[model samples]
Target: MNDHLVILIRSFSAFFILMIIGRILGKQTLSNMNFHEFVTAVILGAMAANFAFNEKIEVIHLLIALSVFTITSYVLAKLFLKFRSFKMWTEGTPTVLIEGGLILEDNLKKNNMTLDSLNQQLREKDIFNVEEVEYALLEINGKLSAQKKKELQAVTLKDLQLNAGNAPQFPIELVIDGQLLHGNLDSNHISESWMNSQLKARGKKLEDVFYAVKGSNGQLYVDDYKDNIQHPIDME
Candidate 1:
């Protein structure tokens, strides 16, 4: 066999095999690319590259290595979900970097993070001063999550002494895509008669609504199927 032809065949084979293994491992691993996933991705990429170019290595051996690693990754994910101790062992717990506006020097040392790095991360989150942070945690994914002190937090309607009524029926989907959810309506103690009355008041029927929800403000919000817009600007 020609060397070029052998290389072409092996490249395609490695490509397709990687794709198959990726699908089996699931989208969460690929999309999030967590700790375990990061290691697996690097190893798989190296193995695939060697499989494509390293003619000295047998194809069967490469396939077996890929399969073993893929299986290990898939099983570990499942085990992590069901077993807390196993998960903690593989992926260490979140470390508290700051508490009550005080940076924990010891915790920072444990994470091998310096004051400059911690400050940099906080600055990335728009916190220029560490004193503004009520709590900060170093997540397993190497991301820093911080909570602002009460005084530093954004003021809402409640803080302004304005009456912003709560939405109990919030997220209640009364009608979705011209289809009314009978179960949601019944569960919420709402009736079809009330829904019909609201539609009638708007001079619209059930079919006219693309989406409708009982908002958090205890108000009926409805969207038309046909927006009847001559010029609509799409953000995308």
Candidate 2:
């Protein structure tokens, strides 16, 4: 066999093995992975890369390394779920960075975060001033959670003492990529004849629609396949 062919085979083999392991580990591993989980992913990726391109390394050795790391991560996740104390120790607790319109400098320093960095994170959440925040917490995953002061919060209809007749229902996706979603239509109490009539009124056929949804206001929103604009301009 050619050397290039052998390399290609090994690369593909490593890719498929990683995919299979990822599937077994489940979605949580990819979403919001904690410290141990992040380390495990990095190690597995390194081992897979070595297995893919390194001709001198044994494939079985790489496989064993990957398996051990994944299993340890899985066991730790399960333990964390079953025991609160273990979870708190492993994942750490949410640190209060701000309370009652005051910044907790001690807590911020403990998390190795500077005042400038904290202010930047606050700005990202649309809060330019720390005085506007009533509460702010640094989550275990390194994300900032913040709550604005009562006076600074957005006003709602209830605050104005006004009764808005009915709450809007969630829009139902009736069609996607020219395919009719019969089940969605049935559940939303929309008839096929009504859908056909709406399409006809707009001079459109079912196949012409790229996406369609029935809004809470009883209006049909649609995007067609045809590009109506002669010249496209980038808004961004």
Number of the predicted model whose lDDT against the real structure is largest: 1
Candidate 2 ranges beyond 4 A from true positions: 158-236
lDDT of 2: 0.84
Local distance difference test, per candidate? 0.85, 0.84
Please give the distance, in angstroms, between residue 102's alpha carbon in candidate 1 and its true position after superposition. 0.4
For model 1, the superposed segments whose C-alpha errors exceed 4 Å read 158-236
Kindly give the stretch of ten consecutive residues in candidate 2 with the minimal lDDT sum.
162-171
Model 1 over residues 98-138: C-alpha lDDT tens digits?
Answer: 87678899999998999999999999999998888888989
TM-scores, all models, native as reference: 0.62, 0.64
Residue pair clashes in candidate 2: none
Candidate 2 lDDT score at position 34? 76
lDDT of 2 by residue, 59-107 (tens): 7888788889878988888887656568879789888898777899999
| TM-score, model 1 to reference | 0.62
RMSD of 2: 13.8
